[model samples]
Target: MQALTYLEEYHSFKEAALNSRFLKHKTIQQLIKKLPEAFEQRCIGQSHEGRDINLIQWGNGSIKVFLWSQMHGDEATGTMALFDLFNFLQLPQFQEISSLLAKSCTLYLLPMVNPDGAERFVRRNAQQIDINRDFNHQVSPEARLLKNTRAEINPHFGFNLHDQSTLWSVKKTGKPATLSYLAPAFDEALSVNEVRQNAMLVIAQMYKYLNPLLPQQIGLFDDEYEARAFGDNFQAAGTSTILIEAGGMFGDEEKQEIRKYFFLSILSGLYAISTRNYVEEPLQHYFSIPKNNKEIFHILIKNLLHQDIRVSIGLSYEEEPAEQGYATVKTYTIKDIGDLDHLGAYHIYKEETLQIEGPIDIYQPANFTLKKDNMILLSFKNGILQSKL
Candidate 1:
């Protein structure tokens, strides 16, 4: 029953979405104006381009939680999911959640942390410095604003949000990591202190809830301690920080489906934080989430009888901007050619008799056609490959 309610809430929110990929400062400004009287807005600081870095607050409880997304300009998935969360927060339909969240928590949201980078859809700020790695140096003004906000609020929990590449697959499964989470370690020791454990427990519950729906599509990020990262620094400052990376889903090119899981995790996290429901969760489940594996390819061809010998190849897609807008398309290249007896891919093809039709020049464009008995079976143009086999 609760799962159904969650789905219904997401549907209602998505149906009323005001913005998706083209979410800029003006869009956010106009959208927040329509928020119910419960929401309070403030200009925390200015970006490198003099854009207002805004903060929106709701609820009044002592369990203060701060969530910021799009620190990297190109990572827009979290920003979209946040607005979906905002829509759900305002609905009279979710009165029970509204009451529960309001009574026991204080939520602060900072979506689109790098508006300048978002404008260009680049990874860094306009200054070309990555905010996530600028904790001590303070190379960007946006970085300073986030540090100041953290100092001002002293939130009990911090959510360091961003989008990850679609190519990451679950270890040994070849399934895309639709969503990944991490409880940032507070120190180089990477020990699970009480504060860090709080984050793990909440994450464990989220993984438990999502595993049934997503199966092998979840992952645990490698916890190599980075002293300059916000999540690590926040954890060091005694704020339990959880990192959520929005990866790819099967056909969620716009990440609409992945956004639903993001919304669900946020809802579940708030409830767990408010109720301490995570305290009873097993820590092993947190570790059980597959470690982020970078070995997988987007597509693979195996067991093809080429010249009477089986051959396998791996192909990786590169993101290229589309003709006329902020939209982009993928262009694939042959990353490797070998006996890949172990690697997994979401899309795999097996052919009894296959021929890698010319011109098979390695430096040329990733264009090819597969033929069997003088008949074209598959053709890969640019990055998209369509196969009849």
Candidate 2:
């Protein structure tokens, strides 16, 4: 009955996380074609580029919940997690859990809210609009569709899912925040009303179940009020909206592990809501979770002297997203240079004395070279690193 044990059943998943990275519209359409007829689906709207924004509805219970993922299009972890849920519910072993959920809660899912952005594997749609930020303005068809769906369903619970940068960390823990949660503020004062408190309670339930598995990797996102964000607006409208940000793992560049955590988290939240398990929990637990801090780096270098002054550097990936018709490729580059003690790095390189060869181009790191006593320390070409150490 525990959520952790579900990991044993995940391997049997027909729609596995292993295949979900860089998922394009064609790939998703093919996968959804194989779903059982019981999971009802229909086009809620069309993207600016004419791609279908699909909604999959399930369950017949009194309380209803709505979940949407990849509104940013580049944030696909929760989308993969939903497909896993779709697969798990069909298996015989997990039928009771699914049935129990159905008896108490009805669920609606919008798996890909911005298919045009997903087609380009980018954050914005063809109109260059951010669907999440378009809530107030309804500038894009996707935003309008989400608003329409909310009005039609009137769901009691809303999960606003997204993927965060890989470098986010738990406050002062120096650990990459693997999974973070936020019960967003409905107003500028960031007050905790009943609906917002309910969302926080559910997040505490998730932390209770998953924190033991990840320890310091768990984080609480800042609850600053963003008036135009969908989660805040949804909470303002009385739905218990929870924001889930799937972040980085130490070595899991593809974030397959984080996707599994995403799946577990969703199931746990639904399980809590269906049974009213979070009704008695105090808000103290939610407030106790560490806040997510912005001080993690994928690469770090230390003590490279320039003009007799010591300097350190932090670099990041400048990814080149692939269109639906093209192969996916990501490149890393030197994004910044600083004494970044505030941030933690998964990889660190340090030395007493280092030398820079020729005139260095801060804007063009691809052709730069670092050397020490005739031995090349590192070289960058087209954002690819070559290390001689």
Cα lDDT computed for each candidate against the true fold: 0.81, 0.83
The sequence of per-residue lDDT tens digits that candidate 1 reaches over residues 1-389 is 15446876567777345445545667777787777778888888899999888899999898999999999987887888788888887778788877888999999999878998887777889889999999999989999999989889999988888889888877877778889999988788899888899899999887877788788888998899998899999988888899999988776767878888887877778888888789899888788788879767776778765555677877777775453326667677877676887787656766666677644434345578877788887677765666545
Off by over 4 Å in 1: 15-22, 322-325, 359-365, 372-389
Instruction: Score every model by TM-score.
Output: 0.92, 0.90
TM-score, cand. 1? 0.92
Residue 89's lDDT within candidate 2 is: 81
Model 2 TM-score is 0.90
Error of 1 at 70 (Å): 0.5
What is the Cα-based lDDT of residue 200 in candidate 2?
A: 97
Give residue 170's error in model 2 in angstroms: 1.2
